[model samples]
Target chain A: MDLIRFPEMSRGELRALRQTVDGAFREFTRIWGDPLENLFAPLARLLTFLENLLIDSPWILVLAVLAAGIWLASRSWKIALGSVLALLVVGYLGMWEDTMRTIAMVAVCTLVAVVLGIPVGILMAQSNRMNAVVTPVLDMMQTMPSFVYLIPVVMIFGLGKVPGVIAVVIYAIPPVIRLTNLGIRHVAPDVLEAAEAFGSSKWQKLRDVQLPLALPTIMAGVNQTIMMSLAMVVVASMIGVRGLGQPVLQAINNQYFTMGVMNGLAIVAIAIIMDRTTQAYGRRLQKHAEAGK
Target chain B: MSAPQEQGQAHGIEIRNLYKIFGPDAARHLPAVKAGLGKEELHDRHDHVLGLCDISLSVPPGRITVVMGLSGSGKSTLIRHVNGLIAPTAGQVICGGQDVAAMSDVRLRAFRREKTAMVFQKFALLPHRTVLENARYGLDIRGLPAAEADGRARRWIERVGLKGYEGYYPRQLSGGMQQRVGLARALTNDAEILLMDEAFSALDPLIRVDMQSILLELQKELRKTIVFITHDLDEALRLGDKIAILRDGAMEQVGTGQEIVLRPANAYVADFVREVNRGRIIEAQTIATPAAPGAALPGFTVKARSKLDRVAQRMVEAGAGAAQVRDPQGQLLGVIDLPAILNAMVNSADAESEE
Candidate 1:
């Protein structure tokens, strides 16, 4: 029976182990919780400020800004107009403020992911040991169920925007880091050898040769991170993140089909806008690669 | 020969008993290699590839030294040692009396920055940077002010025949043009040593010849200590003031092109020189017979430095059976007959072995 079914820890032993781990984690949070929260206070403030700015602005002005940004990124009036129409549709459906909050959350989470992820990626690219260590950690981050980690995060930050932001960032950051490392590593070796022969120091090589060459790949990573952040918004709403996700969560609990479909379509609209704008931007960044060929 | 000293003091590079073994346990196998474990045997026995072995050569300043070999012959590895791009397993690279291998990382960087510039086979220009920006990359690394670097870079860009393409990126340029940019970038550094690792091997033959001419023209003015690597015997003959031959990670012979052609050090070199156009390589003086004192000089005269083919053409034009080989001062060095010139031109290893 033990061979067929898997042997397990006795109930008392399992309970004792769980109690010890839970107690230790609780103690750790009690000691470190306030300082860590304070450390993230500025991030929380930035998130709040961006959300407020988006929600409080005249809808027309925000629409105009988004249209201009899309136009600049895509260099096509059609894409910009389509994105503007999609945002207008989301607004007309009465999901305007919730959509704005989701946008703010995704934007802030993507920005933080890029800021923290690129350096980590560069470090991994620079050393075999770092790559060996970080690669498995990234794999685990991507594979681990988000809800399992959410328990600890919610306990520490106590069900607010910061923990939600942290959870989204945790879900989103791996792609950027992995792709940045890949991009930098994929830079032509002969080019790197040339830089070295010309006496470029480590930092100079990274900045001038590796980073610029890796920009297109890094942008792709950024796009993936943004998409992942949006995907995590609903999961994040379960921990008190207020967004279009909240209505979807409510509709799920109450079995309200129209409300769920409307909110889901709104999320899809934003994803398409972001995906097209960023993909276009990434393509533009690699114009030199296509110019002569 | 002891005339007045020239303007710039010659800073020749000398490689002394250098050996490079590739693998984690390279240092452990150095003694066995020094004692002459063959390259194949060492690789088979110890799993260590010999990159270079017991290489000793003097690269004279103000002249091009071409290291010639086919693929896997260690020609590329040999040039990398000069710039400290690859550390030697044993021995020293002495340039301007400074040991390159002994320098600290900081000092090596300073040395490479101040004294060396390298051109690669692939024309490794940064794809993202413009022609002008790429040209000034070395100066930028040295932290030169932007204006000065731009001025110098612009001068070189024009010098290398890339005048109006300042804003164009590398991908926009043709392969030959990209190599031109590579050359301009290296020249812009104004470094003392120019290391070219098969710099034109990737170009079309016509373009390669064009680039070779440009390099020679530039070398006439620059007089930088150039270490050029190539597998092409023709390029080695054309550019090298002194030529070093490598075979299976060891020095085969090092001399003037004519010396190698006339007197190959071993069978491998003899085989390599077998297909060479001997008339173009063997100079008139090298094959000339010593003239007797007060003997009547031949009616046709050719410079001692002129290749036998030119001497032959001139002799044919002058309708003479023989020609006098003279130095620049017009002093007769030797006499060469038409028959001897033809004989030397078609001479091959098999013929010599038969003799």
Candidate 2:
């Protein structure tokens, strides 16, 4: 080793490796560009359409709608009042429009992720081979740094709200899938055997027994997905996706501490509202299941 | 609707050369297993746990066939194979003249729906469904109309003595009541073959006795081909029309309860019957003296099927020295004296001690 001394070659080798990786990716993109665009365009259109619908609504009406949703989910007037108060504070702090945009992004991202993730998770639960394949991918998705996703997302979809939402969906999807798989797999073996003995078809067993029992756990996953969606959407603002994150990003660039603090609080307040509502709803569902028995 | 006719009921379930080996590549070791390799040896040599071994059993219709064994004796596996829940490595499960193991997917599904029902040890009532809904499950799966299914379910619920609890959830009921719902659900299916895998093992002693009696009473009219599995020898004796004893995945012996208790075939069967109350299990036919063709018949009579314990009580109460044993048709088949009944009640313990 002393004789070889490596010739101080590490930097050159690393540069060459980076160049090779970049060339390979470029070639992949050149070959797969059309199919990839076709695949993502519909998703991008759907997300943008939802974003417009939410952000275009009047502030007062939107606030009322959110407060009512919170009330329905939590079944507590006190929680509803707190949510309303938080919304008003965000408005007073001049972050109302930005907060709405962020909420819209999170809602759509979470919805899309759940719709796609649950069935895949069910498939995973039904087959050990599928589960074996999906588990490592899920581990990577959950553990990888959020910043790592933006490069691929922006490179494919280009910068904007669509790319932002795509990033958020990628970041938030694993929890729902993992939890749904776990919930179905964790259903009592006796219950499943009973279903089998009763001549339940595979679909019937899944729908009648597995899904109903797994609902609370899946709802918990939805809550986690929503929370992760919110976080990812804020970070997504770095690539020109406007929301509360935009103001915070601006504040960071220019050292405007007040703007940063206000926007940050707005995001936190939104997180708290969603967390309490979803958790309360999950508890109510569990109680309802118990009472049903 | 007319009552379920005796003809339409399944004749018998015939399990022939049944072998179950659990683990990947289970079939690869079937030859070695059937050739006489032990369960432990199979596991060591081929990494397959033998679940059943050459189990040949005939479960007669219109009777309760109780398969008795301790845990890991493969009784559960054997029962599951009857309903095609578990496939055998090498065997034929002939149910209703159709090979259950050989049925196609669609046919197996239909077989399960139209011909069989099961009562679980855990009383596997759906937690979210009310008692009535749980009872209605089999009918619902059969695609019966809601109104008609509800009526059938309600009747079974009432029959099982869970009348007022139809609207209550499974969690709202006691264990006994929940099992009643399980029974009601199984009955509502009206399937000819009822597979009860340790159906009453979870109940308290008193409740277990009650459920056993209920099952026996209903079975008198239902005449379903019921296969009951249990670890308790007492339960098997009490409920089984014929009992099959299993040990370490192999069938040790199979016969009437009286035959098993009176003359155990092997050490394993003997150990199982060692603590059994022989008086209750030994039928009057086993100890009855032949009635003379022209001799004067006794005034008092006992049923040929009566257990020794019951006939002994009757003889004591009536103060009869001897009683004619009448068959179900009331024909005098034989005579059972008080001493014979007494001997059957007391001699079992002596016989065991001598062994």
Candidate 3:
């Protein structure tokens, strides 16, 4: 017994295990990569279309639309004006195209995450077994190094916007999924019983009662997903995603301090705008629960 | 409004030999439970909590049958059985000649939609939905068209005195108003069987009385077969045409308010009725002496259905020693003296036993 030096796998054995796993994954990717890339072609098109729509639109038009959207979602003229001013500064700083690209990528990533996450969350909430199985998977996804998964993703999709989107979504989706499950599970039992007592089928109960009541919490989850996706922008740029993150990556490599800070500030501005708008929207949804207090 | 003839054909619920054991392997413990295993012993030995033991009740059509018990006495569990919200470990809940426990998933959903509505103690209105929307929830679940559901919901909202608060959310309203919305929601379903699980228990005492009056007033017209659960003896007396008392997951007694109050089935039931006002529950006819045929009845006559307290007041007002108790048809049934009323009012069953 080698108690002092903990027993471990032999170096040769470890090397053999690594090579075997790598070889198997390489073979798997060769066999399945084209089909997987084809399946995501439409998503790539959607992302490219959105990116062009944002970047190619007249600068003032983009600014006004974003301002209007912020106003509508947040119902706050202050937030809308602040966001518009921040975007103007970013534009004046000559980072307009990069900021737009980042916004588009984050938006798509958040949408995909929400669209996929909520159903999985609802399933997890409905059954204890599903919850048990999915909770650990979510933990692993969140805790594992992001670069560890990127290798397989890169091998399959080759390096581009689709792989970047997949990477960001994997990194960002856990909050929405976790929060959606939590929100649905936290609905008052009596209210759920009332729904059943009124002959609400499972679908009816979910759509009418669970979804509406859980909306605020789910909105919070979406907010968190957007924030997480934005946080992953710099990391995603390493996989050839063109965004504000690219300049930051270049700045890091070339040691240009101002470029790094400026691009980093642009990401922060977008994060604040998204965060405020969604938080305000969630509060508005819960206005009924707060009224007459 | 349904015709009286059609209303007369409404279904009464019959819950028979229902047993609910809450645990995994609940069915395996049924033999031991059926062999007279007590609730505590079953819990200690088998790790199975007995929810209800051999509960059998007949809830008459167009009348309120209140199941009275403390929190853990399985009153809520018993009400849930009628709606098939909880499947019994054994036995049947028969409504309209069909066993609720035996219903298929689709059939049970249809049955609940078509035949039953429920009111909850916590006023479980959808906080997101406005009062009108909450009221219309049952109809919406039944897939009623939006316009019709809204119209019917509006009518019931007004009927429940929540007319102006249609757009108000549940949290914005007081407990009483929220419960009114709950009642409107249940009534708008147009369900024959209305299940109220401690519906008014969450309200203040005065508000509870007001809600009871509202229920009684509605029942007069709607005549829905209502199963109301309560731990408050006064509420049971006020609302129940037939009251079933439960203790420790077992039925202690089942009878009219007067029957339970005047002659309790056991010491446990006697102890329960001890604090109840006998004057309010006991009827003049129940404690009256048999009068000879063709005998001259007292000038002061009270209806046999008149509660003892009312009978005493009338006798006192008339300055008569006793009053003749008359049936609803105004035919004299018996004579009830003031002394007897006083005796019954002051003397509990335990006191009588001591005497």
Candidate 4:
């Protein structure tokens, strides 16, 4: 028996497809605007409160944290010495305790971003419906006035390190999510398909295929998040964050030029350390995935 | 052991009346499905597209079924169903006695974890993990301890001939090496069914052939039920036990390599067959019959099942007039000469003419 084949799509069908896509794009852009904007200060306060809770034993915590940071960031003794000196100067400037508090807040915020960001990125990569939903959400997160994000958190959590950390997380999370999604989507479809044929479950596929391939991008996100968190810290101190931001803000307010410059240097040092370490980790992941191939 | 494995052996994937329409109106327009009158119909008139239209087929145990078509053919969508990567709008994918379409999230997860493996054209190894770790990832997702997963991953890495470079990431590897790792990753999962979506199309010609042979070697022993998707007629001929041609989300034809080549049911199927090197595709075991001539004082002979391509090549290269054929035990079976080949060629043409 003979079988029949369909002809190329008719012109009318192409027009319909174009319309559907155009309509979707329009809705997407429309949804990208801020759904909320007046919640920055309350969010900043909430970050401060959160910071206070995690900073119970400032000196010891600072020492351990600094050492670990050195171990992870730049293992060279000179860099470690520099890191230590940077901290001692902050202390001498009467910002010792505050430095520790900010460090704690930054650390907690980084952890939160990593934890929340990866799964969502994987979900976006795996589902068309989910991605369609998330694309607008991501667009809004990235495009909304950075300060506007803080308002809701400030209102809910109230001023302090808690609100400050919240603000940092909000700013820092988008890159991580965006990069992670890109990496997963770019993973060799063949490799993931191979994994599927091997009977990998969704999580298995993500952990095995998607997450591993995406680690570099996710790591890039981490680096971005860290830099962003540091950037936001200065902004956060305007509310009540005690660490470097507070001193910098106070220095600016009081016209203490030397103090402002010195505090800014400290934040810069922290940012450099976090950025370098995460970048190194990302490179390592890229190398690892290549090895699989 | 025999009882458990026998009970566990799957009949492989069976897809039935699958429909994946892109627009929201797909379900609503269900009763109006017609060839050339689907998404393209809506799309041409209203800019809508129906991605899939009632795709159905069964991949039997230990068989390689190639889904062939150009882009927009819905071949990829059909493969996706076998592994439950995309749920059909309306249909069932039965595998290992389970209706994949009806599976709950947890069941789907379990199915993916244990039953299916896939390979893509773009060798998707995890960038962060070392080759060993990437291989272990499948095991890891199933809750295997890191140490145990690593142990098996190491073995697969070696199997794919990537022994010393366990620590390198996906980016550091060459295209071919990455694909090897892809193979190793799937091997590690040891899933009974393997789905490939143009997995080698991205590779260079030489590397693609090498990979094909490697796949052959792996499948010879593993005997996994494999459903491979590709537009390349040569690839389909080389790898498939059966081939299903899809055009616009509908099956054009499904048959064994010989069946499709010798008797294409439609013009679309014939179009693909005409492009293949027939001598390379049909085998001695397939068309060779006992002729009176190959009785070379009687014992020595090529297996009747020897691939015709191999036999034909030996004939051309050695300038031999005829080739002897044998059976399963290598017993002298028959002689096949130029006439047999010419006969096969004519039959193929007749099939195409019928189409």
Chain B alone: TM-score in each candidate?
0.95, 0.93, 0.95, 0.88
In candidate 2, which residue ranges exceed 4 Å CA deviation?
A: A3-17, A24-49, A288-293, B1-7, B291-298, B348-355
lDDT of 1 at B318: 82
Error of 3 at A66 (Å): 0.9
Per-residue alpha-carbon lDDT of model 3 for A1-293, expressed as tens digits?
Answer: 65899788999999999999999999999999999999999999999999999999899999999999999988999999999999999999999999999999998999999999999999999999999999999999999999999999999998999999999999999999999999999999999999998888999999999988899999989999999999999999999999999999999999999999999999999999999999998998888878674
Between candidates 2 and 4, name the one with more favorable TM-score.
Answer: 2
Candidate 1 lDDT, tens digit per residue, B48-105?
Answer: 9999999999999999999999999999999999989999999999987789999999
How does residue B106 of candidate 4 score in lDDT? 79
DockQ for model 4 equals: 0.31
Q: Tens digit of lDDT per residue, candidate 4, span A159-251?
A: 666666667777778887888888888877656655655556666677656776667677888788778877878888765667788878888
Residue B187 of model 4 has an lDDT of 74
Order the candidates by DockQ, highest first: 3, 1, 2, 4
Q: Highest DockQ, which number?
A: 3
Global lDDT of each candidate: 0.94, 0.88, 0.92, 0.74
Model 2 C-alpha lDDT per residue in residues B203-321, reported as the tens digit of each score: 99999999999999999998999999999999998899999999999999999888898889987787777777888888898788888888898889889888888888888898988
- Each candidate's TM vs. the true structure? 0.96, 0.92, 0.96, 0.71
lDDT of 2 by residue, A100-143 (tens): 77887788788899999999989999999999999999898888
**Top model by lDDT, which number?**
1
Clash count, candidate 1: 0
A185-206 in candidate 1: lDDT tens per residue? Answer: 9999999999999999999999
Q: Write the per-residue lDDT of candidate 3 for residues B284-309, one digit (tens) a residue.
A: 88888988788877778888888888
